[model samples]
Target: MKATKITAIDFFDDLSSPYARKRFFVGFIVFGGLCIVAMYLDHQFVPNGAIKAVLDSVLANLLSSILVILGFYILYTFFIGPNDGLKEVVPTRARDISEAMKQLPEKTRSYLFWGRSGSYFRSSPLIVLDGYARRSKIMTNVDVLMPDPFDERLINSYRDIKDSLGEESDGNPLLANVLATTICCAVLNANNRYLSVRVFYSAFLPAFRVDLSDNGSILTQDDKSKGALFFKPSSEFHELLRTSILNEMAVSREINLEEATFKKKKLDSGSCTPEILARFGVAEAARSALAPKIATLIEERRHRYT
Candidate 1:
């Protein structure tokens, strides 16, 4: 009935780890036994005369060597100490957004993703719709935000950027796919009773994509080739990203998709009804152009499962 609380320990803890706790206990015991043996040997081997002097000199040299090593280590630690636990949490770099999503935990209390056209999220290996549906069933609060596809100027500008980046040149097909994906999201929401899904349309597009889960946050550029930045839940960067997304959500227009439906019959027929598009506010003229693209997306998904 209540949302699950996810902490640092929960995110870091591999739910199905193969490593055993007993092995660590056994290793600790072995280390203690070795230390006892070494101490015993040192007690028994107390030398006299020239042997004593030689042993003393050897001990002094060994102690000096250890001190020198410790000093160097201390210096190294002094320089790197500020980043102590931080480096372990943050990866070197994510090659792209998908790679960055892989860094986040699979289970979360809440998940928010705001991007252009839901393109990456729709096709992401980490955030597949089937998995998302399952998460929704478990009451994960999911929010999806993107630029309004119906906005001609916005789509044109988006297409231009994609063209510059050598991506797909046709924004119309992309917007159609985006609309199809929106219908799928509506299907998810209608099936689930909890805080499952909400879609928001913004007048303007963001330069970068933001994905926030219970575990952490990942900020990525629109261009897939560019690197992404990730921050753990408690970090300042993470909070900043979270706050920015929340603020953006406050101003964006959240659309109602209650009328959108995807029956098995529709998939078999390879058709997205105009009524669904009407609910999404797709203009009459654009519906014809989008219909085939929507059908293509549905067929591809069907093939994926069948």
Candidate 2:
């Protein structure tokens, strides 16, 4: 015979059902104890006279109020179900990424991310990969799709979207951030045999960012004020998003992380010449200014991972 494990959820589930005799008895006992306390207080605090009668009446009223409140709570919890008064005016799939991740299965082994730049990946989605790598024994594959730096039209689209959102950058930081991310992925994939990271540069720019896993997907945008949207496997758009991202990644230019030359000096230099960036899969059109600042951003935070 197998042993059964008892959990608080089991008790709560029982309490919510119609045959909640144990919970009802517990409530009754609590009510009785409060009545005893009320009676004792009424006797001790008042003299034996009309004043005592008034005291008894006051205590009775207090006890009655408590009983009514308790009864209503029990009835509401057991019969009426949880109230949605605190719910959001306009509901979202999940509150944030952490909450969304919790809904995914532990066995998920693939992740596909499509976005304009590496900033979002560097900030948030990288942590998910690390976390999954720590516990999973099976091989995990990740595919990242972003616009090709050399494609002026796609790059301009990226800049226009950022400018519209008041995040005006000539795409230098984005390119540097992508390089730093590529370096980090190189090191991560090398160290962990089970993790495979593939980064692709495409000639297209997506309107929104989509992160797809085996069981669910998360949609986000550059503007942080507009929160993320989550989709379950059953959602019609979930499969559509997955197919679109996969299709884009298939034809995009993939960077050879292991073969790519990652020179600390070149990245940290004040200016990145066209030749230097082209060697490491960055577009020739990418601006050279802010290489030192980007190097500092990578070294101070993401360098440790590398």
Candidate 3:
């Protein structure tokens, strides 16, 4: 025979139930003991009959008020405790990226896009690729600045993640996909819908949520993120990104992902010229480093012959 564990919940249910006569009688006995103690203290504290009578009345009122308040609290807790969860909200201060993803609207016009950097390097654009492919969203015509397929920083980052999290990320589908392909990955909810947009910058992703709506809000992972001011996408920034991507698509030769290869002869500094990227507010150092990487990827594409 298996031994049954007696839980506080089971004990509490018996004691609190109306039909528990023995328990209720014992509770009254305890209450009587408490009353005796209170009365003894009161008599000792106020020996004068006239003053003691007045003090006793005041104390009785105070006790009655406290008891009433406590009774109300107990009643409310018993009646509303279970179902009150539905009405409770996760305040913005308490919200994290994971929680924000959970509340995302299934079909939305925009993604809450953000990705951290390698201190100064541009974050990966694989997040965009993953979102576009997984969502199969024709309506969401958003612009994304992508890294070269074989960008040194990007490739290195991918290798680092794969080596570090190959087996560890197995259970987490999102993490697994991200590890599988360093370039692009998306996470799906229990319903298999796309979760909010954000990219992995380092090996570990922090829990933070930002809603990139017309009027957006941010919930960061920690005090550091909290202190950092979130950026609002400007029209100029949006247009610049769109133009950059379109320009890249226009100039690049068609090649499938698997078939793509770097062309040493075609690789030129002009492919990711700083002059072009500078106009779009890309930092001088970032643009200089990023240009070559971007150009190399573009030049390397194996153009299909008609």
Candidate 4:
């Protein structure tokens, strides 16, 4: 079957809804409150002599504490809070582009993974984003890390290109979404590949770095006499890889097959229906004849941003 095509309209359609806007405001308020409370507690409990002296000179400690808390509440609520809002608001356009890019085809996605090698486990965020972008038909550009002169110029040029394509002065929102999606895609693909390889090889592989050539190339060493070295995959091995991919896709998309399976099994159960089984693939079934584990590998990374 052909893959689904996602469009820019699909990406941005639900974002501007009243419900979404309310949720965004609620999130900002909660974050700002937490920041204010933490700042107040730190300033109050830290016991600074200078602060004590100032309090003694101006007012009592009780009043001082109250004043500090009120001051910080206002400061954070007004200045810092709105800055955070801008960060969210400005990134909406970029985010839409990133989402649109996710619908790209797999062959195009694989190009992002090509220039890197080293036990396959150390594949970076950029590579994964490229792969997903190619696979999903998403347009993505890597933020290259290099020394000062090259780094600044390259990144600036990249932003300029993105802005030109996007028809916006600042590509901040789109860039933010691209970076976020890149990280998400990288983590998801690497985890899937790592689990698949580990199951296939029955061994753990250490992550390692790979150096890429200036022209974005990597050399693969081949031992010709060892015919079918990489080409030889048993039917069982192919099944395993396919199953792993399906399960990874399900988990990434937050689809709970087990619940669906359970409801279906109650209705009619010789084994899982072909459609359900096909959606998850065999590895999921093999993991448990009854239920598949539902959890987010990507959600764990939310702490990094929050």
Candidate 5:
């Protein structure tokens, strides 16, 4: 089916519920109040003149130090946090992806699966395509889709690809070639008609690449590059796959699938007044409103494609 346009609201509505919004707002208010109190204390406690100046300097330094420490802590929590623990967020998605891969055929399975490295900001999606050029045994391409800019770890990872192949030292030829190939593939594979992946970064910045063509042909020129063969699945396909995987996983754990489905329904309803008081949470009313429209779009695409 043709992919439907996903608005910012649709994505946020699906991902977050009213309870999540309440929690976020409460946290915001508390933090904001604390910051206001801190500002008041700074003004009230300082005597004025040189004494106030010294005190301001000290307070500034203290705040800066705290901010720096907090930044590092959040970074660590996102990246190198424990994977096998309940506290881990990204690992849960990784585990789900791994489980989903097992349900597909061996050859096709690799095409749909990839593991995330410990570096969160530097992490990218990995997929093994059917055909892509390869100097060594690895025929996969990495697509860096992180919302943030590329960091040192990612650059180093690209560099390390050369060392990975022990004897095939073409003096960093693979690094340069891979970078160019990835950029070319990413540009050709972009979803938007007007914007190619090359636009992801400025001319001065580094860009990521993925294997787009069937069987890696880095240098071939054509109207439709072979790289365009890396299929982009429709949203319906993704939604159905996600739902099936979640249901299967729940069943394997001996959990009552009905309760999970009910929870999702409640969330979709916008948590105003759940059927059961105890289950009240934020709802995604917008999703339900959009469902019929999405269904129609899917049906039209299916008819056209078939």
Candidate 6:
């Protein structure tokens, strides 16, 4: 088996779209008929002098209007072109996005999570979450979120990158999916270090920054809105992160085992799933499992900071 080549066209091609070529043929035929009718009318009506005068006047006015509009458009583009590039101004926060993450409840805040674009997550993260996970033992606070490689959503999400990976590993029984395998390798590498790791079928929301703590913050910027301020997390921002994480965790759990479970690991069982999800960081259901544990950790941090 081989990976299907990904091109711009492959991703754009609607896998289930109804055949539409026949509609194009119908359009061309209609256009031909209209052209014939126009030619026939031209031959049937010989413009008398009055009609010709009226037609000339209409054409003249139309041409003059078009030229004026075109000239105005040209002048607008010429003057506006240079400054147009600078029109979009990104907000300059007093701190970077990671600084906002630091304001989250300390214990739950250390875990680095990924969602949506794995490629983008590759770009930004906190210093502690980045390197500390490797150096420290599985301290109670360290956790990480990742996609379950065997889950269908995992491959389908990054299916666009298979072409760049050189071959589809999914085609063979022995070969695993390329991107999945890479992530799996990373998980194994971290697991060996005693880093707490959880894998899911998909993400609840797109990740802007990696702090997964219920108390953490997410910064949002609109391309259309210029000079927006980036501030530390407010209570509302904390709620937003908490809710989104809980939703994704709940949905991932709600997916039927048969549909969502990639490999039948120990956590797949009914009794074990909730315990594992809680340890891994699902809120509502997992609250019983880890909330007090996290709260205690936060208190410990406050004491240390003092």
Residue range 153-230, candidate 3, lDDT tens digits? 554554454355442222222321222222121211111233332232233232332333332233343223232222
Candidate models: Cα lDDT each: 0.60, 0.61, 0.36, 0.31, 0.30, 0.36
Model 5 has an lDDT value of 0.30
Residue 96's lDDT within candidate 6 is: 35
Model 5 Cα lDDT, one tens digit per residue, 238-260: 43433433343333221111233
Instruction: Sort the predicted structures by TM-score, highest score first.
Output: 1, 2, 6, 3, 5, 4
List, residue by residue over 10-64, the lDDT tens digit for candidate 2.
Answer: 3334343332544565776687687778789778876799988986887687778
User: What's the TM-score of every candidate structure?
Assistant: 0.62, 0.60, 0.26, 0.18, 0.19, 0.32
Per-candidate clash tally: 0, 0, 3, 15, 13, 1
The alpha-carbon lDDT assigned to residue 176 of candidate 1 equals 71
* True-vs-predicted CA distance for residue 160, candidate 5, Å: 47
Clashes of 3: 3
Worst 10 residues of 2 by lDDT: 1-10
- Model 4 C-alpha lDDT per residue in residues 1-306, reported as the tens digit of each score: 111211122322343433454565576566556656655665688587886566444444444555575566556646644322111112223223222222222223222222111112122333444455546654433222111111234346545544654633342222222222222333333333321111111011112111121112121221211111010122233334334433433333222223323332221123223344344432343324322211121222221101
Superposition error at 97 for model 4 (Å): 16
User: How many clashes would you count in candidate 5?
Assistant: 13
Worst 10 residues of 1 by lDDT: 1-10
Which prediction has more favorable TM-score, 4 or 6?
A: 6
Off by more than 4 A, model 6: 1-109, 112-114, 122-130, 134-194, 203-215, 220-234, 253-306
**Better-scoring candidate (TM-score), 1 or 5:** 1
The TM-score of candidate 3 is 0.26
**Can you write out model 1's per-residue Cα lDDT over 1-306, one digit (the tens) per residue?**
112222222322321111222343355456555645554565578655786566556655655655565465446546643332433234322333444575453767577887776655544522343465475566667778888887888888888877887766764634775676576666656655544677888887778777788778877776544555667786767777788777888898887867335433333224466666776777887767667668667556521101
Which candidate number has the best lDDT?
Answer: 2
